[model samples]
Target chain A: MTEHTVKSFDDELTHLSNTISRMGGLAEAQLAGALQALANRDSDLAVRIAASDAQVDVLEQDVQHFTVRLLALRQPVAADLRHIVAALKIASELERIADYAANVAKRSLVLNQQPAVKPVGAVINLGRLVQTILKDIMDAYVEQDVAKAIGVWNRDEEVDDLYTGLFRELITYMMEDPRTITACTHLMFMAKNIERIGDHATNIAETLHFLVVGTPLKGARPKGPSVEAQ
Target chain B: MTEHTVKSFDDELTHLSNTISRMGGLAEAQLAGALQALANRDSDLAVRIAASDAQVDVLEQDVQHFTVRLLALRQPVAADLRHIVAALKIASELERIADYAANVAKRSLVLNQQPAVKPVGAVINLGRLVQTILKDIMDAYVEQDVAKAIGVWNRDEEVDDLYTGLFRELITYMMEDPRTITACTHLMFMAKNIERIGDHATNIAETLHFLVVGTPLKGARPKGPSVEAQ
Candidate 1:
């Protein structure tokens, strides 16, 4: 409880936040690069994006180590405890988000070998939407803005709705032309990955909400219509 | 540092472990019931399985609350700290696995409304494979067996291979008979859900490995052949 101890604790928290921000930036770049690779059919760029995922993995380890140290040594109570826990959970979420981006890049590498599907535009749009949501959620975490986090949480419905429409469109494309099935299937997987990224963002938002407000977010998360046909 | 405090801490750990076991049992039942519903085309059973997902969600909240309290109050260091953190991550993974089960059940309900696809048997087999993997990983977590966890981790390749084969078969079914497209599409999503459940189980295995040892699992996880056509 001395001044030096408090300062060191604050410094540790700031370092954790900065590390997460840096990881977020890397993940955003990977996602954007993956989308560009998909658009241009650039297998080399896709490969590079996939390779860069190792950096994110390493950063996740650093964050985990730091967070655990803080929890054990500082024994942060109440909101402080929640903040450290949220950082821990958010770090994991970011790592998974990065993995999804890498998965998209991997899919792009495969898709490049085939004749490109016509629905790349829709996929790019979905990717961009998810990337924006991710950015907003990360900002919410840094600022501890519950309102901003909730905004990102609700925005996932948009991603879900778009995913459902794209799912149907891709399914139709595959059905109508057997030649496009292979490419469309990969694109469908990429779209689903993007959608899952949005879900991870929502999860971070919910964690942030819990950290800022003592209670967990009430009620079920709003889900868009199911993609299943009636 | 007192005997009573140590006894209480041990009791808390045991309770935490038991709660996770109960949650795992619920998730396993949900997965099995969903598969049974799919096999029998039992819409009622599927709906019930979907409804039961709320229980898993609640249990996840309980796990989170208990974990945070333990971290703050006991401030466990080293291996005990790692064990609690692993429990936290494993709980989230199990909740997600349960969500996948509920999603499969929801898909089953949709499939039940339509004429059953001939490939439902294949879907059931895939679900069973994933369920076995999930059960094995949970056991690894409880027993703190790194070797057993790694065994389950490597087995994920089997699920991925099965998913790839089934993906091709379903695509072929949709292509050859447009009438089966709707049903086949739903089945494809359910299969994907099962494959993802396998991935979640692998994630838990990695967490268990980390908890047992002090380091994260090394090397890239084994992946099956790409789903993309050559």
Candidate 2:
């Protein structure tokens, strides 16, 4: 309420934002490394991803503790409250997204032991799209760019479209050669996980939009099932 | 410091818990009815599940508003604060679970318009598993029964196994007769959604464990991709 308190609060909020961004950066790196581990079939890479997850976990907890303390101490309302909540949701989503990446890398290690079935091009493409969306979402949050956040949300449709295309192709492979079933199944899950990452990224974007506009950008409309079926 | 207000705060916390249970009941019903509708191809049942979703949405918003107001006014600390935070997370998950039920019903309406590919038995089985775990998890939350919550968390593995079996069967249908692909695909999304519902139930179970024990229950460590594949 006082001028001195306002200045101190501003400084604390800035540091809080940076702490969240640092955590985001670690999550982003985990996603990229996991995908690289998969592409290369490097078990060592997968092991490293699995091992380093604790760092992300630690950062996630730090962000949460700091945010909750800020909320309780500062009693922030309106946009300030929204920012803290956005950070909270973003932290949870990014942590889960990192877990998915670790899973994918682990699968990659497993797949390497077997003969390659088909080019993992489709799965790789899906990962790239999701990774870009994740990166852009963090950028939008840190920069406070509503336009960039909306852009991240719109790109989700494209990622879904790409995954659908890949699904159809996988189905064709299974139909033609049942032998490819094993590898193809991993591809299916890998694709699904990547699609979910895109969904999480979109969630972050929605949160950002709410922080900026003080209202939900999307009307909480339910998304239809994946288009990749037939 | 203030005995009278402290007593009232306890009552408020109790009411919040009760409200969450009421909402959880609504979501559980939606999930069960949607599954039944899909299995039986009952359009009337589908309509009912879809119609009830709006009420769940309203409850979700009410919980959101209530928790935010509680935090702002009471500025709860320690255990009280964790309970409210957990309620917020549980409310969101329950809302999303309801949305998944609506999704299943929508898919059911489409699938019903077509000829049957195979029996909806497996899809129904998966749905029942989800519904059971969801109900049990709520009970666990109500009683703060750590054992029951852990039981629900572990049951998620069975749900995953059931989903994998369904996928293999659907693949056979598509391979045998491409005509079955459309129906099978709708069925696949329904299965995926139910599996996700199981996941959310497990999440609620985790939340309960956290509240009762002051720590999170250790999960199955993400399974690290399947060496067995599918």
DockQ for all candidate structures vs. native: 0.38, 0.26
lDDT of 1 by residue, A1-230 (tens): 89999999999988988998898898889889988989888989988988898899999989987887787788788778877888888888889889888889998987888887789999999998998998898788778899999899889788898988998898788778877776887788788888988888998989889889978788778784364411
Collision pairs in model 1 = none
B-chain TM-score for every candidate: 0.96, 0.94
Question: Estimated TM-score per prediction?
Answer: 0.92, 0.84
Best by DockQ: 1
Give a tens-digit lDDT track for model 2, residues B45-81: 9888877888988988888778877887788888999
| Reference-based lDDT, residue B59, model 2 | 89
Residues B1-230 of candidate 1: C-alpha lDDT, one tens digit per residue: 99999999999988988888888899999999999999988989988998899899999989987987888789898888887888888898889889889989998877877887799999999998998898898888778899999999999888888988899898788778877776887887789888888988998989889889989899788884353311
Kindly report which residue stretches of model 2 are placed more than 4 angstroms away from their true locations once superposed.
A1-8, A218-230, B1-8, B43-58, B106-119, B160-189, B218-230
